[model samples]
Target chain A: MGEYILAFFMFRYLRLTLRDTEILSKWDKLLQAGMITSAVLLGVEIIFDSVSQYTTWFSYLLLGYIAYLIYWKAEFSQRKSVFVAVLPFVIVSFLTKITSLTSTEFYQSWEDVYDVAGVFSVIWMIVMLVITNKQNKALAREREKTLQEEKQNKIISQMKADLEVQVVQRTAELTKQKEELQQTLDELKNAQKQLIHSEKMASLGELTAGIAHEIQNPLNFVNNFSEVNKELLEELQEAQTNGDLEAVGDITRDIIENEDKIMHHGKRAEAIVKSMLQHSRTSTGKKEPTDINTLADEYLRLAYHGFRAKDKSFNAIFKTDLAEGLPKISVVAQDIGRVLLNLINNAFQAVKEVEKPEVVVSTRHSAEGIEVSVKDNGPGIPQDIKEKIFQPFFTTKATGKGTGLGLSLSYDIITKGHSGQIAVESKPGEGATFTIKLPKT
Target chain B: MKILVVDDERDIKLLFQQRFRKEIKNGEMDFVFAFSGEEALEFLDQLVHEAVLILSDINMPGMSGLQLLERIKTNYLEPPPVVMMITAYGDAENYAAAQRLGADDFLTKPVDFKALKEKLKTLT
Candidate 1:
């Protein structure tokens, strides 16, 4: 049985290491020889129970085969071969029993070699167990570290996703708030413009009143004397008719020349007073039903004359289209007059620097409202500042030339005072149209 | 009748003389001109009796017509001269102020000559 266990172990070792057909055949032959010898020895021990000396010789042959295996596989694995070499001593007590059967003296002499071989086998087993335990512990530690890295990566990705979501939400909120702030800024700018425009209008009104008062005195003298001279002329003619020829010549000459001076200056003063009244009349506060066509036509001519007084060489082709039979609207005539003046003045300025300057003022009665448009052939407003044009103190004119309150005041007069609408349309190189729409109500 | 015309304009002296030449020639009326309120007051101080009428322009370089009217009403109490206030602006405020200041009449510039003649006739 012991020989069969050794043969089985040798076969397992040969299957693990022997890949060459030549090495495999040698191992197979040695294993067969060991098995046949052990079988024959077992039969001899059964037949001659007293003659076991031959069994000891068979164990020595087995030990010699194990030494040969150790020498042959030494280069393959030194540690495994050393462990296998010690395994042969596990059956050393059976070898001693067979040697005792042969001669007691021979058994006593081999006892020390068996003990040393048994100790080597025990040491090999302990070393193998320690190595295996350490390998297992290292493998478990590596698995745990990999697991921890994977968990940390999952948490980081989750945090990144949450941060992205929060950023998106915050960006949306900021964008909405920014839009609201921008809207408030626009409203504040509009209010500031309105305040500046009213201030300018107040100063302008005062200046106009001063001029009116100053001019009226000279105008009064001209008219008074002109009337008195007319009476004097009639008296002089009546005197001549009664046949007073000697005194008549001097009187007629003096009176006629004086009448001419009176009439000439009288007409000049009248024209100036009329122009001043046309432009500078204070608003009456109460609404009056008025013919819009007459108001527009009168103001257009007055504005033209006013511009002419400033720039003697300025000339423009002015056209008007007054819708006939339009219903008379109730409005504060002087206030509406001021609005018309501002729009017409702006139109004139717009066309001043352009070739073939033309200003067309047109009125139309429509289902929407009373539409008045002041169109000019001039370099139009640019797109960027188009929305800001009506803001107070926003002017394209040279400083000191314009107060920049004309359009702003006009906007207030039309939109707030009259509950009307004013809008502009323009292209960069083309002309511009400013339309004022007053509701019929 | 003698009338005092107060104004700062030098041209007014000629204008009045020319306008009333017929009346002056017929000896029906005479005009004494004062260029300022001070001159008018000085002229009134020298006169034994106040002029039959006084026409003064409201806007003058020195003393205004309203101030002259105040002085005339206070200084000449015996036969209070018919002091008419004339201004270039016929605004309500100036008119009201002149009337409140004891002006006998208020006339806007380019005075209606016929209207002035009638007022003068009635007063005479």
Candidate 2:
């Protein structure tokens, strides 16, 4: 009966402790078979008292099966304690069975062995119950720890996902801001291009009167020479009709000379017009081999005459020291012409109030590179504002007289566009000289 | 009459010589040419009373025509030469300024040679 009870409890323990349901179910079926066999044997024992002797062996087989299940299927940690609890009961039973089987006399004399076995079986039951309770408590604590770790892992993953989302959002925002800043910069660049174009037009506007005067002089000559040629031709015809060879020769020479003068003056007028057109048109930024001396001379006269045309009383002795045999440099002619014009105009403006105002434009080929310098004998720039002169919108001129972008634009054209250098040297009360040095390359 | 024609244009000398060829050949009129106001003043300083009439352009480097006129009028008091100012700018301001500075006549270019000749004949 104890064996049957123990088998039932072992089945329950396996059901409770074993994680594999299939294995637990197998153990349950095995235990049921054992109990059914024991029930059958118990029935047989009643029918034939001789079968009672085999009941002990059947109980041993049941105990061995339980031991095998506990040893093989139970958790290694639970197996040791289970074996310790069952060992005393198993040994006591074995001893009782041995005494009963081997020595009938010893068995009758030591009938107390059955009582001892009973006491040990009770202790084993108590130990098994305590160990099961302890294992259950430990399992519950382990399960709680596992649940806590799983929850912490879930929270950490959530925080990581949030951080990734924040990173993406921040990156998106930064990219948008960068795009906006780039757009603004592009707009500003377009505005700057328009401003530079307008400045070029404005300078051309300033030159209009002077260009008119220059062209007018040549045109006047053209008209006058043509009129003179007409008169001379009429005189030559009259002389021819009169048959005076010397007078005819002289008159014919005069007519030819007048025609030549007319052609010369006409060409001059055309050149002036062409230069005016070149100055007014937007630069194509194409570099070509250009004579710097001729460019400097042309712009010097233009700026001088332009200033003189504006203020009739304005006059200065302008000189040119063009170096002979200077090699032509590769440059955008119109751009360099504009730079020269701006510098010469500034020189004229600086020397406006000075007595004996003189401006000198000179070109030279030096070891450094090709250099064009415009020097003036005027009141020089002070040291304080000298460094600021090349900055945009920095002008010492009266308002409305200057746009203040001349030097700054020139600086950009020479340095950024051409990879050159432009510098100003001035001594207070003496004069100022602006020099442009372009590289050979 | 000895006349001094002052202008910055170098071609003016050739043009004047050609225009006044008959007068020059016949010795009826004498002409002197100076390319700038300073040159004209230098010529006048050398030959004090040789030139009786001076035709000067108002715009020239180193010395303007008006400044030259002022100097000529102030310095040459005795038998001062008739000073005529010519300018491309026909503005009233220049005319008034020239007049104020003792310019005997003011003319705008392109100068009408016919009218100028008639004016010169009347002056003579």
Q: What's the count of clashing pairs in each model shown? A: 2, 0
TM-score, cand. 1 vs. native = 0.42
Per-residue accuracy of model 1 over A228-292 as CA lDDT, tens digit each? 66776677688778888866786777667666666765665565555456444445467778778
**Candidate 2 structure quality by residue, lDDT tens digits, A268-356:** 78877877788778888899998898788778877877898788778898989998998988998889989999999999999999989
**DockQ for each numbered candidate:** 0.10, 0.64
Q: Which ten residues in a row have the lowest lDDT in candidate 1 chain A?
A: A75-84
Extract clashing residue pairs from model 1: A220-B109, A220-B110
Question: Highest lDDT, which number?
Answer: 2
What candidate 1 gets wrong by more than 4 Å, as runs, is A1-149, A202-215, A218-222, A225-441, B8-17, B24-39, B42-52, B59-63, B77-80, B87-102, B108-110, B121-124
- Tell me the deviation in Å of residue A147 in model 2: 4.7
True contacts kept of 1: 0.24
